[model samples]
Target: MPRAVLRARGALRRALPALLVYAGVRALGIAVLAVWGYWTGKSPHQLLSARWDSLWYARIAEDGYGYTLHLPGGKVHSDLAFFPLLPWLERGLSAVFPLSAGDAGLVVSAVSSLLAAWAVYLIGERLYGRRAGVALVALWAALPVGIVQSMAYSESLFTALAAWSLYAVLTGRWVWAGSFAALAGLTRPVGAAVVLAVWLGVLVALRQGKEHGERGEEAARPALPRMLLGAVLAPLGWLAYFAWVGVRTGGPTGYLDVQGGWGNGFDGGLAFGSFVAQRLFGPAFAAGLGLLVGVGLVLWLYAACVRQRQPLPLLGYAGAVLLLALTAKGYFGSKPRLMMPAFPLLLPLAVAAARARPVRAVLTVSTVVLVSAVYGAFWLNGSGPP
Candidate 1:
């Protein structure tokens, strides 16, 4: 072979393990969903395209946000139930392409998932090294809830926005970070976490500079003000949508009533925790036990964070993600999937793995693949959560 061709081959060979790991995990997850759909006498396309959560998004896309579903209990207001960003994008993209609102949502989600993986690579490489970047990306793609990444869901899109926004914050691109945070806030209610983390980082940097009595350009930085502005911009889109819904419904409480219709009213975690405890000690106790184990796993991750002295930005991001996951109502079975965006929590372990032998790395990745494959398959079959 030519020298250039040989060098390119070598580079690809070096990257092949990580790529294969990612592909294998995601492929298994997709295969599981496909096989289950077939066995259940359901079309894979419909399974993939069916309006699950996508239905509400499509409604928002086609109808431009309105309240409906007046029941004996009350009016179930959807406008306040979902954020406007994803549906708006779906509408815009469908306008240009001859795709249904659902198809458009899936296309957007797939693209966002790929971009999120790339962003993970960039952030991991910057924080640790190339191997850590590769491992982290693979780990993220192989998550047991991997099916969500391929569905017409907002998880992938939100992760992409959050990851890139954090990257921008770390690189001192304050305006870009703020812009992305605003978009993320519009996409999901959790966008506040990224905005808060960035602002806190800026505040810490400023305080350190002042304490040192430095007279340099770095010391007189105007980062805090920009960070605060970024934080403020994050929630505007969600608030605007709620306000519109309130005006149209002729009551500010209309949105909350809609969420209550789906048993997702924000009454706090007490009721939710009781429901989970019942599940844990009841007939489906094994699954509840597994969830408790997952909580323990999160605590272990927190301990690792302290041991490794990981940055406050990462810590805050992970904490916010955990809080959101735990505080949510309904679909208690999907908590693991909901927490998938917090993949940065594994960066410390990924960095450590980068220093191990190639053989050990392969073994570690194989174990993850084997377990995730089984778990992912069960999840797709609707045997896991509601």
Candidate 2:
């Protein structure tokens, strides 16, 4: 076989353990959901593949967009607020198989989740080691919102693209990084995080080249064109979609206006802070405290990532994702799902786990898996969107 094929086989062999762990953890979650749905007289399939954004994506796939819903209180929701990539994939998948668009979406999400886990592992391994990579995958798989990974939603697809883009940057494959970043941009608004990673990686490279001597600069000159090309490509998909939305709506700020109609905007966290504050004074005080703790933990993780001196790409991506998740004004319940793409925040914990005794690491991950499975089951059975 060729060298590339040999290298790929070797990489898969190394990633197998992490993949297996992720699969097991997710399987446990699905099992819990299945039992809970059965006992609660709900269909697990419906829960995973036909609710909330999944319903919107399936409708978009089947109907080809141009949907508008007038909510009470003068809120105008448009299907265009949902990104196109997931719907496109669902449409294609359904056409190729004997499945409805909704079912096809679940398939798409399942495959994408595994791919995302693989990319997450590769990035951690590239930065630290195999153990750290495995730890990172387990930590990510056991996240409180990990159930969303298996849902027929865009999170898995977006995360796969984003993680691969970050991996491409880490491996110095600028063109690949840009390509994945663009695909990510097409998946969700948070895809901007991956674009930021690619841009930051390029800028950092260019700066390092500047700092080098004349000989080193000459050595770096050949890669400069590709780096520049990658940076240019990073935002094209996002810009293209936004431009298309603008044209379709017949206004320059059409996309922004559409999102605004859904009560989504960047308010620098003021809206989110107020939302939390409101809960704290009511019977929901405990829930408010829990929310505060969650936010604090995420912020602390980012701080730990920074203290560990992560690469600029990881730092920039994490920072951008953090900013967008906390600052965006929308359904507060969606914050955890929005923050799911910021996998780099788990690095500090992953590194610690990798350094710990094997038994301790396994036990901790096992406990987290149990918690996530039970919480996911309970959360899904409730009348709320994940």
Off-target runs (Cα >4 Å) in candidate 2 are: none
TM-score of 2: 0.98
Model 2, 1-386: lDDT tens per residue? 89979987988888999999999999999999999988889999999999999999999999998999998999999999999999999999888899999999999999999999999999999999999999999999989889999999999999999999999898888999999999988999888888999999998887887888787689789999989889989998898889999999999999999999999999999999999998899889999898999999999999999999999999999999999999999898889989999999999999999999999988988999999999999888877798
Provide the lowest-lDDT 10-residue window in model 1. Answer: 377-386
Q: Which residue pairs does candidate 1 place in steric collision?
A: 77-258
- Clash number for model 1? 1
User: What TM-score does prediction 1 earn?
Assistant: 0.85
Model 1: per-residue Cα lDDT at residue 204: 59
- State the C-alpha lDDT per candidate: 0.73, 0.92
At residue 245, candidate 2 shows an lDDT of 95
In model 1, which runs have C-alpha deviations exceeding 4 angstroms?
Answer: 1-24, 70-79, 216-229, 249-257, 265-268, 383-386
Per-candidate clashes, comma-separated: 1, 0
